[model samples]
Target: MRKLIFALAPVIAMGGITLAVAQNATTATREVYVKARPTDVLSSNLIGLNVHNNAKENVGEIKDLIVSSSGQLSGFIVSVGGFLGIGERYVVVAPSALKVTYSENDKKWSATMDTTKDALKAAPEFKYEGRWSK
Candidate 1:
């Protein structure tokens, strides 16, 4: 029994080391980004931003962003036809629909769409429920 215990000790220690190496291999598979590109815009700066039309009319306010599982931007939730949040409803728009720009002189970000407030209000509304619940 003493000899058997001594024989298993090295195997048990090797198993623990193998388990640790496996854990490190799993961790290394996840990608890590260390630097931000110039085109990257912080999501914190986008929320609550007023969306305007080409005619300089405020169409909607950016309420939320939808990100896909593949790490891509899926949609932008815009609130339209709201009077101090009383009658507002959320509408999901494609990220390409909004023309987002940054002005170097004013150091401000602006978003514009070739649409009107009435057009946005007439769009299909998105309700916060289930997976998108507030």
Candidate 2:
């Protein structure tokens, strides 16, 4: 009886360990935060974003990202048109249209529509009106 009990003890311990590991694996994933500088964060992965207007014309490139006081990504400030920044227009794009992706080869972000520069320029600029769009 003693020998049999000793043999069973190891098996029982292994079973309990397996059960604990399985339970942990099923738990929901948690978000992790990493420390980064403000200037570095904005400059990273934002410089080459291709900007298109409502008419689907490629307007320009992303100049910088604007963050709100609450530490949330507000919008993208893009430089459009003009030679040597003479006639360039800085437009703020909503975050909804932006898409960030990473593939085997190229890693970049883009807007999902063939929006034209003129249309983007004409779209209702972001405002702080109390009512939200329906």
Candidate 3:
């Protein structure tokens, strides 16, 4: 019985180590986001969402996004002007230009830009093409 217990001790320790290693591996690839209070949002949910400035001025809405082949977000196409998007035009801005945050007080997601509506309207139009990435 002593010999059997000694042999089983090594196997039990090995099994415990294996279980710990498997748990670590599973967590390594997992993405963690705070539930219900997230300041982050998926791009699909952000499309056509209203954007405002710091002073709570309505600016424009996000129209489209440009993504790199390496899966990096390159630019955002913001549509400005028009009523209810009737005559809205598209302008390109770097992804860094917009700040996305959830307002705890407002209980909503907000997108803010440094520039104003008029300036955004004056920005050069961005036309999407297959060769734009090239």
For model 2, how does the per-residue alpha-carbon lDDT over 26-112 read when each residue is reduced to its tens digit? 123421222443222234655666765546567767766655443345666666666786866666776555443334365444443
Per-model TM against the reference? 0.76, 0.50, 0.62
Write candidate 3's Cα lDDT for 1-134 as tens digits. Answer: 11111111101111011101111112345323224323234566568778888778988898876654433456778889988657888898777778766667986666788889999989998765667542
Q: Which one wins by TM-score: 1 or 2?
A: 1
lDDT of 1: 0.68
Cα TM-score of candidate 1: 0.76
| Predicted model with the maximum TM-score | 1
Model 2, residue 12: displacement in angstroms?
Answer: 46
- Judge candidate 1 at residue 99 and give its lDDT: 71
Model 1 Cα lDDT, one tens digit per residue, 33-128: 234445556677679889999889999999997765533466789999969999998899887788777778999878888898888889999999
Question: Which is the winner by TM-score between candidate 1 and candidate 3?
Answer: 1
Instruction: State how far residue 78 of model 1 sits from its true place (Å).
Output: 0.3
Candidate 1's C-alpha runs over 4 A off are 1-26, 29-33
lDDT pick, better of 1 and 3: 1
What is the lDDT for 2 in model 3?
Answer: 16
